[model samples]
Target: MSTKLHSAVEVGHLRKVRRLLTADGANLVNAGDGLAEETPLHLAARLGKADIAEILLDSGADPQLRCRCPFVNKFDMNNGRGDALHIAAAFGHASVIEVLLAACEPQAPDADGYFRLLDLTAMYGHVEALNLLLERCPMDVSVRSQALCFALEHAQIECARALISSGVDVTTPRRLYRPDGKGIRPLQFALSPYSDPCDDHILKTEEEALELVKLLVEAGADVNANATIAHRFGRYDGCDEVSILSCAAHYKLLKAANFLLASGADLNAKDEKGWTALHVAVASGNPENVRLFLDAGASHQVTWNICTVLDNDNYKFTKKWTALDVIGMCDTRILDLRVSLDWKKYTLIGDYTEVIELLVEDGADIEAKHETRYVGNTLLHSACSIANLSAPAGFKRSEFENGIICMNTTIQRLLPTVAAFVKAGANPNCLNRFHETPLHVLLSGVMNAIETVSGSYKYHHAYNWVEEEEKPSIQLLFQCICRTVRVLASAGADLN
Candidate 1:
């Protein structure tokens, strides 16, 4: 073969190459002029030319010559050693594979001490060629097989099964495990989490993935066993100790959860969140799992809020009970009590007329304080904040001072609850334990509004009210000063 014939043979132009070879009287063994150092047979095999490869092999071409191209790039055009069998296996040509395997160096190990043919077949997911190599080839199966590279990575189940049944030990001491505190096995690799963030191949859905888990479990694999390979792969970098039961629960595998649980997995055992499996069930919103936890004798604790209150409440109280009853009469939630003192605070803030009517219908405490600190402000305190606290002009006062505090006023026309608070005997003057009066709060509100208007502070620009023309409704500071003087005169507030 001439130097140019190498390119012709590589492209499977056997007829043209033969004519040139015959014309030049050059033998098939001649090397290419290029740095390939490849024979006509090497070129044919590299291009996967089976017929041309046979002709070159018969024409006294040496099959043992390794091509200049790497093993991964080589193709089999003719039956040749090193190169020919690898190409046949790469393309999954079983007949060509058999011919090359018969002629090639079966015992020869590549640079990796693994046969290139087995690796090629495994990469292609070729079950037949993989089985033939594992069962019959003189090549060492103990040496890592190429089947594992793709078999473990892509999860070629059929090829893996064939390799396993052909007596390739599923727990073989291959390159799968690392030297950790304890020896990890190949079985663990099948169950381990993916190392790559982009690799979703660990298991796509709960079902397809669980089948592998179940198979390994059936093969007497440890369900709760923590393999050392996790440490080797850096998978558990930030993870605490996680076992099979924990993994199953984390994966939300109910069947796996049931298996792990039934096998005496800790149903109440907490993960990093201190959350039990019951919490997981509830978070998943799976009612069936909720029933499972309940059946497992899990107790449902009553949350503080009524919105999230479970039917599992041990104290059979009505939903319409008071805040005092909910907190077991403890005075700790006094701020919550203040916020919930009236219907306005607890209920949605809306139209004063409707809110007042609704609270009146609910039989809310008209003059009751939520706690000792919240004295004098009933739901009326909250209603007054919205300009809704109303009372008859002749109504007497036992909750605060004498009949000087009039509840009914056309103040409802002034922005609902804030005006209502003043009308309802909520002394904008009532000092908390901190001695901060409501005027202090109102003053802060005024300053915040000014800052917001001037853009000196960031404000929620969504609902900004730019003054088209400053309306003279008694200035806020003057009104507050006047209200303070009137409150001191009426109720004798200690301004000093």
Candidate 2:
């Protein structure tokens, strides 16, 4: 008989519930449902059926009757087992929440020992429901912290603001309700790029997110809070204690970055890996952010440059690399800057030409050489190597065979980049540790290409005409090579 009443209340059949309650000796108001062991009132509140919930309450339903369900360990399901108020709050049932709170102690936590109604409502982004509960009961310090952390993690702006206004410590590091067991403060979550949960919708625009950040800052949130989460789950290496400014620069949150900068964030703050916001900006290929950092007077100091003296021999000084050296080696093909790989693979290619120009214009050592096992190549050498290895585009074999040499294509594509270095006074004859110049790097790449193509014909004796067919392609390749070599030579390269 109680089972029938439970079913009626679950589907919001108010008349059926009233009928069952009026039956002879039917005591079913607080009877636990077969599944999840939720009482009839729990079912009504969970489904946001205010009429059914009110009827259950009127018929002596225990509003504080806890659900006998296992708690899900995920952030969204952190407090799986709860009472009528918890259920109503989790589902954003404002009317049902008011009914449940009237019959129950509002500040009581749920059965799982994790969430109060405030925490549950904030986690699920139930602003109205949360407001209803807050009006009746005061949130304690611990509960306020938990609610605000959940609110920030889920991007629940209004719920977060309410918690903040109620004096929740924004800088307090609460244990994140994930399997990894790391503690993250509210400000760190706000700075995170992956804060948006799959279930809840909050902070739709950059402007909205920035406003929330301002609110947190105004509420005494730490702008320099360190991120304790590991980066192993993603492409970037997770550091032990990365600052919020580094996170902003890494994720390219321009407005947030500017705001943090304006708020007196430590511009020179280094993470556990010894990276500042400038390193992160350059590494992430965000030239705009890099420019911002530079414009804000971010130090261009690197580890190697710091150790070496300016009065040291030019050759010895060139051995130490800097951010400019890292930019020179950025791979043009890969779009994602956060991918884990060799630091030398962090170049921006042709896309961020303005950034490269900016770095040079702002006094980055244009002729800075990278110390490697094979060579100590400068930025100019790196540029030449990239151009030499890049595949020729839009070249037909017949055009080469017809003696149509398109030097303009080479000039238009890559020569200007080399010219930028030369115009900035790059030493065309500058030798690496192996005594090889930029011309030597270009020649080696060209030779390798020619040798690879020539070896293909060596095994083909029947196709004598194949040599003729190969002539145009080889000529075209050599044409680009010669034009580049000519540009370097004209720029005062050592021919010998």
Score candidate 2 by TM-score against the native.
0.63
> Where is model 2 more than 4 Å wrong at Cα?
1-7, 22-39, 57-82, 102-115, 177-182, 196-204, 233-239, 302-321, 326-350, 372-375, 379-431, 435-496
- lDDT per residue, candidate 1, 1-496, as tens digits? 2476776776778787677666662444556544555667655655567777676665656556664445543352232334556655655656555556556775564434445676666656778767776666755565433355345434556665665555554443244333332333444344334423234345334453455455445545555554222321233332233344534433446665666556555555543324345543433224444455456655444122322223355443312223112211111111122111111111222223322322333343334443323332333222223111112212222221111111111121223444333443445456544454544433434443333223311221232342222211224324543553454345544444
Report the lDDT tens digits of candidate 2 across residue range 179-284: 5555666776675534433223333355655776888899887887776644322222342666788767765678989999999898887765466778778656
The numbered model that scores best in TM-score is: 2
Error of 2 at 313 (Å): 27
Cα lDDT computed for each candidate against the true fold: 0.43, 0.64
